[model samples]
Target: MGVQKEKLVQVPRIENGIGLMAGFDIRVIQEFADESLRATSQDDIVEKFRKESRQFGFDYFVALSLCDLADPPEDVVWVDQSPKGWDQIYIKNDFQNVDPYFAAAVKQRLPFVWSDCLDRVQRSKGVAQPTHDMLDEAASFGYGDGISIPMLIPGTHRGCVSLTGERPDLSQGPRHTIHLMAIYLFEACLRINKSALREWKAKEFIALTDREKHTLQLLGSGLNASDISEVLKVSEPTVRYYIKNAKQKLGANNVTHAVAKAMLYGHIEI
Candidate 1:
């Protein structure tokens, strides 16, 4: 059996974001950010994020950095604490394309809660699908309430951190404080990852999202972007996005260059 998640200690809820903004221990937050930024690897960065996030009443969190805009990858560069079963079903169904929160995060440059997105979906005309299904599926895994904080990394990529579980006593202030923390955590993630970046020059390995990996595999099998789009059931633009994003991450000049680097790094066989 999996270990049970710990309940958060109660804190007084203050309105208008005053309590968290004015009273949150900025010192401790800065300290964690400093430590995380100094971390040596991706694993270390995730450990720091998990530890710090839980202190803010987040039961579980998943951090993501989207590398491409046209055809964004789901579940990319993320650290998740959800149950294995939940994740298994998610991957099996390719739900990332339809994940309401992810879709919102990619477009909006703001912080929002899961319910906020759900309501927007409900209020819109000709909505893509049911808002209840999205929230209900999450609740099935014990995630009834949650928040998603999205960030735009200057000159690099867009990232987000999603927290879920038993609703903590978060007021306006506390929520804002956590939002700032996500930025710091993402900075640290990039820092550590940069040092270990799998560049064509260095021949080191870099992390790729599951979608990116699959795309690479398909390309290795002599598939073009159009063919890959049909195979993945995604748009052709998305296939291009995956290819370009992989190319950039591998520090290659083009698709062929990226594939060669991937082979050199043993990420795929051709």
Candidate 2:
């Protein structure tokens, strides 16, 4: 239900020759971070981020927020600025389920390099073929190398902003700077997207009936339909009806998705 993942590491800048350039780039990261935070639109933020990425050496990118991947790939909001052809193929192939980067994000707590995805592929049995194929196809699009930064905004849904294609000389400076940039880009877009969504009327969002709300609350808390029926002294089918109605009201794809949407829209607290 999250974005990119990898354990990001920051090491000392002690290289006599290369350290200078790395130091300069690392410091400039703060400058971009400032600009990103104040960005009001997805386009502006992505434009600035892409320009900066080229300066550091990268081509394609994907900024995504996955609230619950169990639903469908298109269920979450994502900023996909990668090549046009890649998007079509990727979505058509249903590759998200097998993408190593996404799998890593679910388990990893740190930003990771592209190679880390391969490492994950190697560790998982029978998964190597799909991972390899995905990478092989991505390489055809010139996105053979890049960085993945899984973003976590406390109390918010998990997200990721990634830079793909071309390699940035890691020895140039603190790798954490890359992670920081990825996070800033994702967050800027999040704010812009959310601002539009925040205009939704609270009354319309919480259209569920009292019974529906209670049913959803219990469901979100991990109670099953049968349990809820017993607790409410209603038939199992009646409980299902309420849950189904709540899912429709929330525009959710499943039980978990409905729960997440209810929480996000302030309809219910979990």
> How far is 76's C-alpha from truth in model 2 (Å)?
5.5
What TM-score would every model get versus the actual structure? 0.59, 0.61
Name the runs in model 1 displaced over 4 angstroms.
1-23, 67-76, 126-131, 199-201, 204-270
Q: How close is candidate 2 to the true structure, as a TM-score?
A: 0.61
Best by TM-score: 2
Every candidate's lDDT? 0.72, 0.75
On residues 98-164, what C-alpha lDDT tens digit does candidate 2 reach at each position?
7878777766778777675676666766466776788788888887666777777775667776677
How does model 1 fare in lDDT? 0.72
**Model 2 clash tally?**
4
**Which regions in candidate 2 have their CA more than 4 angstroms from the true location?**
1-26, 67-77, 123-127, 172-174, 200-270
For model 2, state the Cα shift of residue 54 in Å.
1.1
